[model samples]
Target: MNKPLVVMLGGSGFVGRHLAPRLVAAGYRVRVPSRNRNMARDVGCVPGVELVNCNVHDPAELRRVLEGASVAINLVGILNESGHGGAGFNRAHVELTRNLIGACKEAGVGRLLQMSALNAGRGTSHYLRTRGEAEQLVRQSGLAYTIFQPSVIFGRGDGLFGRFALLLRFAPVLPLARASARFAPVYVGDVADAFLAAMSRKDTVGQVIELYGDEVLTLKQIVEYTARCMGLKRLIVPLPDALARIQALVFDFVPGKPFSSDNYRSLKLDSVGGVDGLHRLGIAKTPIDAVVPKLLGEAGRQTLLDRNRRVR
Candidate 1:
């Protein structure tokens, strides 16, 4: 029997960067199609991996990439608002998914693996709601599919934890948005492993699996913890929901702005997954504290510089 070919979208992003190598290690040949092929070449450099440049939202381009792929993983998502490029969550989360499903169907891709979020649900913020809708569309596509809805993923290359670490260094006082809301920040490597497992396991098809860290902590707790790990002395001031939402709104108007009201809503709910799925999937959630020190390292200038340089 031959190993299946996995076609990955948005492989240049944080999760995809970690996932590409892990998939290769698991004996699957990976193909990542991105808009900028040169930038994505790193993904292809993984043994048994290929890279292509294509617009995932275009049905024809999607089909071209889907050719000969046994499974397709859609990992494309935008955190900040971008002008003209249509970085809105609705297009990337909903419309792109719709197009991918259609292209998969057309190209006869055998399976679809969707990377989603743990807090995705009705009445949640637009981020969560859009993610929920994308899941619904995937489920209804009449294809063999598995969904991995993970909490805010953290690791060496992850944005969630790394962003907090960056903020703590420059600012002596942390203005926390949704400080009361909680999360179960999963390690990036664990989440990537879960994706590989879902692709190969029969029981994973057509199931929505949620993933989380071993423990839960509030937004404020995570910020404080990250600061403490970096050996920074900082004060955390919890901002009211209204103020946070307004801050997000203001930032949304600026290009490449990281904060927004949608993000505020996303943080309002707990990110921990119900543990039943973890048990069923035969995965033991990795704890956040166990891995933080390794990734962030002891307080040092070189480590901070390395992290900051990666951001640009």
Candidate 2:
């Protein structure tokens, strides 16, 4: 018997890297559509994963990927847009979701798992606003869907900690905006478990699972934690609102947009979750201290090995 085909949009990302292998292990044939196939090559090389170059934002292109697929998962989200406008956020989050829904309907795909953010729709930031907008569409799309609103997700290669670790390594003093902004960092593995749990249980079809970790830490605490894990002594400077706005405005034009005004607006609301979605899903939370240090250690070893090879 042939395995069920699961189509993943934006499966080259951090979470997708972990989730795709889990799906394959669960006896599903995973198809990942990326704009650049080379970006998803790690996934493509994995057994039972079909990585194809296709523009998921395009309806026709998305439809082609969704054909005969049993499920569709959208993990595409951007923290900042190319420029200082809402258009990029809308296109990436809302419009892309609309296209994905239409394509699913056209292909008769029955299930959809959407990755959303905590405090979505509650903030003025384009990132959360469009995330909320996309969630609304998924709710009304009339398809069997499960929406995941996750707090800061942490794991190997996660954007939250990994990015911070890299930045903290260079700077002795870190200027942070909204340092008091709080978050219950969720483990990537628990998040994947929640999705898988939701996938198997049809009762979760109309449910919104807010995934979060066990610890509630502030922005300052998170950065400090990362620095400590790396065995680095760093000074964390928490910027007040006045300074933060200026920082956001200045960083807006920075290449790669390390931070922006939209991100600043989003930080106004705490990223903490109300309900224990992981607990509700019957999955235990993985604490940051246990996992982060180990990953950092391994990463440090790898870095040293690369540096040694370069010396030759």
Candidate 3:
């Protein structure tokens, strides 16, 4: 018996790292297309996963990747762009989705699983605006599609907790922006399970699932929780909106763009979900306490070991 081929567009990213393995374990063959195969080496190492060197943004390349595949999963997204203009966001989110839709139809692909964010179409930021645009394209494409809109996701090696943990280790006091913004963080594994469950269920088609955790915490509270997990007592100063905007403007030019004006704009809307997608999908939400503390402890121990080795 031949297994169905699942083409994962952004299988090299954070969520993809967790989902790809589950697809393989479920007896599906996964094909991941990346511009640089070297960067996706980890995803490629999974059994029944294939990594192809190709530019997914290119319509021709996208069609080639989707050819003869039963399902296509688009997880491609960018939090920030090179410039202040929304051109980069449009290119990555809207344009790529449009291209993927056309490619799916031409290649006879039956299903699509799109990854999106909460409050996607409601914000003034380019990130959310383009996300909404992409969703529209998927809805009108006439293909069997399932859109997964999740709040900020947290887990091992995640950007949320991991990034803050790194910062709390060095900075005595952190000036946070949008400190009142709230989010119900979802687990990476539960999100993967959502996709897996949606794959075979006909009812999931044409539905938008909002995945979120059980706990709703403010941005300030999230940082405080991160610090406590690390056993560190640090001052977290919440900046007023004016000061936060200025801080974002300053970091816009900083290397790697730790924060941006667009981010501040997105934070204007809470990332909390109205409906529970995990529970609806029959998957229990994994609490942060169940995962973060252990991951942080391991990371802290590793960091201490490295620091001690350097000192010696």
Highest TM-score, which number? Answer: 3
Which has the higher lDDT value, candidate number 1 or candidate number 2? 2
lDDT of 1 by residue, 1-312 (tens): 777788998887788988898888888888888788778766767777788878888889999999888999988877644552334778889999999999999989979999888867655566777788899999899999998888788888677667888777778897878888888778787777788878778988889888887778888888888877887778999988778878777877866676776677677677777854666767776777788876666543555676689998
The stretch of ten residues in a row with the least summed lDDT in candidate 3 is 298-307
Which regions of candidate 1 deviate over 4 angstroms? Answer: 83-87, 298-300, 303-312
- For TM-score, candidate 1 versus 3, the one ahead is 3
Error of 3 at 261 (Å): 0.4
Q: Quote the lDDT for 59 in model 3.
A: 94
Which candidate wins on lDDT?
3
**lDDT of candidate 3 over 93-139, digit per residue (tens):** 99999999999999999799999999989879999999999999999
**Candidate 2 residue lDDT tens string, 1-312:** 989999988788888888888999999999999988877888888899998889887899999989999999999998888977799999999999999999999999989999999998887899999999999999999999999999999998888888888887668899999999999998888888788788888788988999988789999999888877777778999999999999999999899988899989999999889988888888988888879999776655665576688899
Off by more than 4 A, model 2: 298-312
